[model samples]
Target: TQLLEQSPQFLSIQEGENLTVYCNSSSVFSSLQWYRQEPGEGPVLLVTVVTGGEVKKLKRLTFQFGDARKDSSLHITAAQPGDTGLYLCAGLPSGAGSYQLTFGKGTKLSVIP
Candidate 1:
């Protein structure tokens, strides 16, 4: 079984602050994805990283995949209150043969204005 562990399960910061969260796993993955979710809504896909050391940026958010494909990170720059939500990291293990995604516990972010 593949499992992902996310650090600092919850985060609270003021608007304009920057934060970085991590997702780690013992298993190697073929691809990893990040998502953001709001109250009463399903998670929205933010970015997908397939190559090792690949980085993708969306406005103030940045996503990076580790060189070994066993970890990933999300960094937010100058976060806003509107950025407050649940952030999730999911991975597709290599040769899983199924479409099931292994997800981290998730990080709940609260940006106070």
Candidate 2:
């Protein structure tokens, strides 16, 4: 089984500030997805990275997959209070098909206005 470690279990910042969260593992993955979860709700998909060294941008948010596909990062520029949530990273292991996933504990972010 692959294990993913997420850094900075909690983060608090003022609105308009920037922050980056990370997910790392020793095992390679076929794809990685980032999600945001609000209180009392399931996580919502933010982005997915499939290729090594690939980067995707969603509005002011950027997502990147490491060259080895064993790590990923999510960066938010000019963070807003609406961005406050638990950010999770999940990976689909190679040859594991689409049913199983290894997930990180998640980074909880709080953006204060």
Candidate 3:
């Protein structure tokens, strides 16, 4: 099974709307990082929550960490075209054996003007 999964692979909405994206997994991680990427550019870090049941807010975006550290969610209030991008969640692995990350396929959000 995929360590992590994201729902609503694609989303399109008008300006000033609201939407939510979900991420799920069966494994645990030391931390989870959310990223946003614009066309032709690498993803930029949006937020990172390291604790179970953690919640962090950035502007109109709200991020939450699952109690088991195996799930997550992103809620966008008042969407705008400028908010269009790819939303990705990556796990920060720790301890022995590689410590590589597991990244969600990504949620493509398009907020039209």
Candidate 4:
């Protein structure tokens, strides 16, 4: 079974601070997606990275894919309390043939005011 490993499973930072979360795997994937989830609601898709070494920016957030397609990272600049939530990374394995996503354990972030 393919697995995604997320680092710093939990994070707490003051408002206006910056933070970064990472997702890694031993297996290669065809595509990878990042999502942000709030309590009592479904996850919201943030960005999807398919090409290796690709970088995408969504306002203060940045997403990057490793050259081998085996890892990804999310960087937040000047975080706010509104940014506090659960962050997840989902990947589609190259030969899975299925549209199902393999999700990482997730990183819980808290931005204090």
29-72, model 4: which lDDT tens digit per residue? Answer: 99999999999999999999999999999999999999999999
Comparison by TM-score, 2 against 4, better one: 4
RMSD to truth, every model = 0.9, 1.0, 1.5, 0.9
lDDT of each: 0.95, 0.96, 0.90, 0.96
Per candidate, the number of residue pairs that clash is 0, 0, 0, 0
Error of 3 at 44 (Å): 0.4
Runs of candidate 1 with Cα error greater than 4 angstroms are none
Return the TM-score for candidate 3, rounded to 2 decimals.
0.93
Write one digit per residue (lDDT tens) for candidate 2, span 1-113. Answer: 88999988999999999999999999999999999999999999999999999999999999999999999999999999999999999999987355688899999999999
- lDDT by residue (1-113, candidate 3, tens digit) is 33778989999999999999998888777889999999999999999999999999999999999998888999999998899999999987644673677899999999988
lDDT of 3 at 32: 92
lDDT of 2: 0.96
Model 1 lDDT per residue over 20-102, tens place = 99999999999999999999999999999999999999999999999999999999999999999999999999884857899
RMSD of 1: 0.9
Error of model 4, residue 20, in angstroms:
0.6
